[model samples]
Target: MRKFQNRSKLSQYLSEQRTKVSSIGFVPTMGALHIGHLSLVSKALSENDFVVVSVFVNPTQFDNKDDLVKYPRTLEKDIRLLKTLSENRIAVYAPTVEDIYENKVVSKSFSFNGLEHQMEGAFRDGHFDGVGTIVKRLFEIVKPDTAYFGEKDFQQLQIIKKLVELYHLPVKVIGCPIHRAEDGLALSSRNTRLTEAHREVAPFIYKTLNTAKVMFGTKSAQKVTAWVEKQFKKQPLLKVEYFIIADIETLKPVKRKSTKKSYRAFIAVYAGDIRLIDNIALN
Candidate 1:
């Protein structure tokens, strides 16, 4: 696989590839690749003529400095894993922090149709703004025909869809399904941070979500949420941040079960010090 750490080199190369009429599929990631990440890569590989995977931990997106500091950096290992996934057919654009932001003189403000005030946006202050900025920058840099993102970050997927419309970008943003482990815990890089004991019980989060999904068919929204909270409260290791049964479209918490629209159970849990988020669809 060809690896380019310089933005100019990568952009110029991708531009050249464009002249050849390459249908480039882009997978932008904050490093520490896991099964979930490779699943998105697999989707990109299956559909596009050429695939470019970016492994940069964007500093601007972090709401907490400590979390940023604690975030793992296994670049060498990550590249090795990527190599194993695709037999040197994939290209890696692992740019340094300086390369991506050296040109930005000022922070540009973004309005994601009020998407910035809910869930992750509400909790992690200017997180999506940073996400919007970096993704917008990468889209410009890569100039791919299509971009792939995991539905694991469901809200972020929606924001990017809006971002493309707002900017009138030509690239198609595809949201792939969330990949989980056999035990049902959604695969995450942060899973590495879970204590040995916590890791064993981490599957509780998904189990509860599964139960909540089944109950949603028979129970009211408020009662379902209450039950989810109570279930989480039973486990000392798994601390629930926010649990809600919300409409899939607006992402606003639905107080009552709706027979018309689809609903999703979204939850973020603090398993030891690792923060994990997962969602499941409910009709």
Candidate 2:
């Protein structure tokens, strides 16, 4: 596998590659590689002639400075993990902050059409703006025919779709399925920070979501939400931040189930100092 730290060299290489390949697939990640990230890369490899996976922990996206500092960076291990997938077709771009942000590190203000103000955006101030900025920059630098993103960050997925629509970028944004642990905990880089005790109870988050999904049609959205909160309240190790059943398109909380529109159950929980978020589709 080819490794690139400089954006210009990578761009020049991709330019040379474009003439020979039918399609180039891109998977932008913040490193701390796991099965979840590998799944996205695997999908990208299957679809495109060449795949570019970026591993840069973007500073602009974190609202809490501590979270940014604590975020995992396993570059050498990440490259080794990537190599296990493919040696020739995959190029790993592990750029320095200076390489990605140049001089100033700031996010570009983007109008996500109220999609940004929903769940994650409501909590993390300017989080989506950071997400938009880095994603846009990476999209510009990579300029792949298609980009793959995991659906664990459903809101971000939708916003990126809007980002592409807003900018009219030629790249196709594809949302891959969420990868989870055998115990049902949604795979996240933050999962690395979970203490042994916290890890034990982490699967409860998904268990509660699955139970709530069964209660969707029989119980009101409000009741289901309250029940979810109560379920977490009983667990001392876990704390419910927000649990909302909302329409998939608009992302606004729905009071009643609508046959006309699709909905998903979105939940954010605080497991000790680490925060975990997961969602399930409620049809």
Candidate 3:
């Protein structure tokens, strides 16, 4: 696999590639690659002629500077893992911050249209704006026919889909399933920072969502949410950020209703200062 650090070279390469290829699939990520990322790359490979995976830990996405500093950067190991995948189908774009954005100039001011003021957005503060801007920039640079995103960050997937619709971008937003570890914990690079105890407790986040799902199966939405909140309260280690049963697409809170349609149970918890996110369907 050829690596290009220079923005001009990479842009020229993709432009030239655009002339030869009928379609391109892009997976933009903040590196420290994991099974979840590979899952995205794999999906891209299946659907498009060229699969491009970007591994730039976007500074704009991080609300706190320390979080960005603590974020993993296993480039060597990541490249090795990517190499094991179909080499001809994959390309790595690891550009510096300047390559993506001009010196001191950034894309910060974003209007999420009320979607940014709830759940992850409300808590993270400008998190979705950072996410939206960076994603828009990436879409502009790559200009792929399709882009892949994991549902682990469910809200992010929602926001990107909205961004595409609002802007009328000529790219398809494909939401891939959230990959999980053998023990049921959602595969996340942040999980690497967890201690054994934290990791053990991490799966409970998924378990709690499952619990909510089961309760939703029998009980009303109000009761299900109350029970889930109580469960999170019981687990002192798992500092629950926000747990809600909402419409999967609009993300608006759903009232107690009898329907076998799509509903989502989103969660955010702090496992010893390392915040982790996971969501499950409550159908």
The most accurate candidate by TM-score is 2
For candidate 1, which ten residues in a row score worst on lDDT? 100-109
The ten-residue window of minimal lDDT in model 2 covers 250-259
> Per-prediction count of colliding residue pairs?
0, 0, 0
lDDT, candidate 3, 61-110, per-residue tens:
78888999999998878888988887676778898888888787454776
Query: Candidate 2: how many backbone clashes?
Result: 0
Cα lDDT tens digits for candidate 2, 1-283: 8899999999999999999899999999999999999999999999999999999999999999999999999999999999999999999888999998899999999998899999999999999999999999999999999999999999999999999999999999999999999999999999999999999999999999999999996999999988988888889999888998999998999976778999999999999989999999999
In model 3, the number of clashes is 0
Best by lDDT: 2
What is the TM-score (0 to 1) of candidate 3? 0.95
For the record, the alpha-carbon RMSD of candidate 1 to the native fold, in angstroms, is 1.5
| Candidate 3 stretches greater than 4 Å from native | 258-261
Report the C-alpha lDDT of model 1 over 147-184, residue by residue, as the tens digit: 99988788889899999999999899999998999999
Residue 174 lDDT in candidate 1: 98
The all-Cα superposition gives candidate 3 an RMSD in Å to the true structure of 1.5
- Better candidate by TM-score, 2 or 3: 2
Model 1 spans with C-alpha error above 4 angstroms: 103-107
Superposition error at 244 for model 1 (Å): 1.4
Structural similarity to truth (TM-score) of each candidate: 0.96, 0.99, 0.95
